[model samples]
Target chain A: DAMVIQNPRYQVTQFGKPVTLSCSQTLNHNVMYWYQQKSSQAPKLLFHYYDKDFNNEADTPDNFQSRRPNTSFCFLDIRSPGLGDAAMYLCATSTRESMSTDTQYFGPGTRLTVL
Target chain B: AQSVAQPEDQVNVAEGNPLTVKCTYSVSGNPYLFWYVQYPNRGLQFLLKYITGDNLVKGSYGFEAEFNKSQTSFHLKKPSALVSDSALYFCARGIKAAGNKLTFGGGTRVLVKP
Candidate 1:
């Protein structure tokens, strides 16, 4: 039952407050990714970690940051949550071998609500 | 740059009827295509992928996709639709050198009426 898991399925934070969403995996994949998915839109890639190397998307905002402390854990940090930042944040994992074909497995997303 | 296009915003199908979700792509070199399904309040589940070889690829939950090189399209299909099959479907494209970064299309929501 190797799968990706996200903590605090639903999160509520005040505007301008910092919040962190956690993701852990049992799949032992070499890559971990964070995506922001607004209602009725495709999941947009925010950043990802290829092993220990962090890759950020060009359009990703400065308020968004990520950390991968170890293979199994990755965290997304929002330095200053905005009302527009309220969306479902998804974490996904994939092996280097399978990544070429885009076989990423996703965790249940964390829905963030900024008040 | 790799990009995907899902033309339809939503598709409506009757139960037991065949269903098709359209997808097209633009990428450098040979394209790698994938289809994923997402239920309400849940993460996306992989349905199938097309890399090489045969044009037709079968995947989980009786879903299959046909890869057309000439059309630059990979369309997902099912012989018989079920009510439980209703969900949001996404098409994505990946490049071999891009690691795990996938360019996804705006999703198409499928509604199977029972």
Candidate 2:
């Protein structure tokens, strides 16, 4: 099965410290996305990468950044983690053909706990 | 702007009974609806999606969703619920004409009694 994979399922970061969450996919989809899902809330889109082009959401803070060196691997970096930054970070991938159908496949999320 | 809504925060049903999870959406153009399920500490698994041609779309785990365009609703249904079906259900919608950001509902926690 071609599945999406994430590293460091559970992470604890000190306040003001930096943290990075990684995601890799076997599906080799054309687009990759990062989402932040807080407790009991819908996941919010932070950013995404279509092939090598990066697109950031409007409300996403500057503290967050994403890097996709290639198609298989994507990384999310949090410059300075705050208590409010504790949440589950999800990574997903999708593809668009001529018809432009978007169906995303999600990976197991990284749970970040900031103290 | 595209958005999705799950009216019920939680739903409870017996194991052998039918189950339904409600979802509604708002979008500029035609809507692409999707349903996802999440177990404890696990990633979300795609249950089903409604693109076109079919009002009742069957998906993984014996789950199906009906697209009601007039009511702007896409509710998930199962003929017979199972205990393993208990999980967090999320309704998501995307407008391809606009952008790719999938607007998701708050999510509904379903509990199937044994």
Candidate 3:
């Protein structure tokens, strides 16, 4: 199946320790996004990669960064994870079109636990 | 500032009963709406979307949403609710000028009783 996949479905990281979550898509989409979803909360967009162009949300904390080294893969790096960073990290991909009508496909998500 | 609001934090419905999940939005221009379902410990699955055309858009898993431009609402509906339908539902709207980023609602947890 051509779907989005995320590594380490459950991640355990110590407070102030750096961690990385990985995602890859077989869909071959040009646009990939990263979202943080807290318990019972909405999935908030952190950043995305339109090909090599990385776009970060203005309100996204500086500690979160993303890298799209190639077309099929994207990585979310937590510089120093905190307790508040404990959440489900979702990776989604969509075919890029200027029309903005395409729907996004999501991975199963990484549940991050910062202790 | 585009946004989506799911009025109820949770909705309880009995199996085989009709269900409605209300959603309202505020956007600068024409709205592009979407509905997604999230099972426990999983990512959201796209259910349906309304960009243009028909007011009633049918989507995956026998789900549908009605886009009412006059009322600025897009409510999800199912004729016969099932126990497996229990999950967290989120409504989202796209901001074209914002690089197609989707602003999601707080999410409404749906509980279908047997």
**Which model is ahead, 1 or 2, in terms of TM-score?**
1
Q: Is candidate 2 or candidate 3 better by TM-score?
A: 3
Which residue pairs of candidate 1 clash?
none
lDDT per residue as tens, model 2, A1-115: 9989999899999999999999999998988999999886788999988899898989999999999999999999999999989999999988855222478899999999998
User: What tier of docking accuracy does candidate 1 attain?
Assistant: medium
Model 3 residue A103 lDDT score? 91
In terms of lDDT, the poorest run of 10 residues in model 3 chain B is: B94-103
Error (Å) of candidate 3 at residue B2 is: 6.1
**Alpha-carbon deviation at B110 in model 1, angstroms:** 0.2
Off by over 4 Å in 1: none
Distance from true location, Cα of B33 in model 3, Å: 0.4
Assess the local accuracy of residue B63 in candidate 2 as a C-alpha lDDT between 0 and 100.
96
User: How close is chain A of candidate 3 to the true chain A, as a TM-score?
Assistant: 0.97
| Per-residue accuracy of model 1 over B1-114 as CA lDDT, tens digit each | 437899999999999999999999984566888999999999999999988899999999999999998898999999999999999999988766655677788999999999
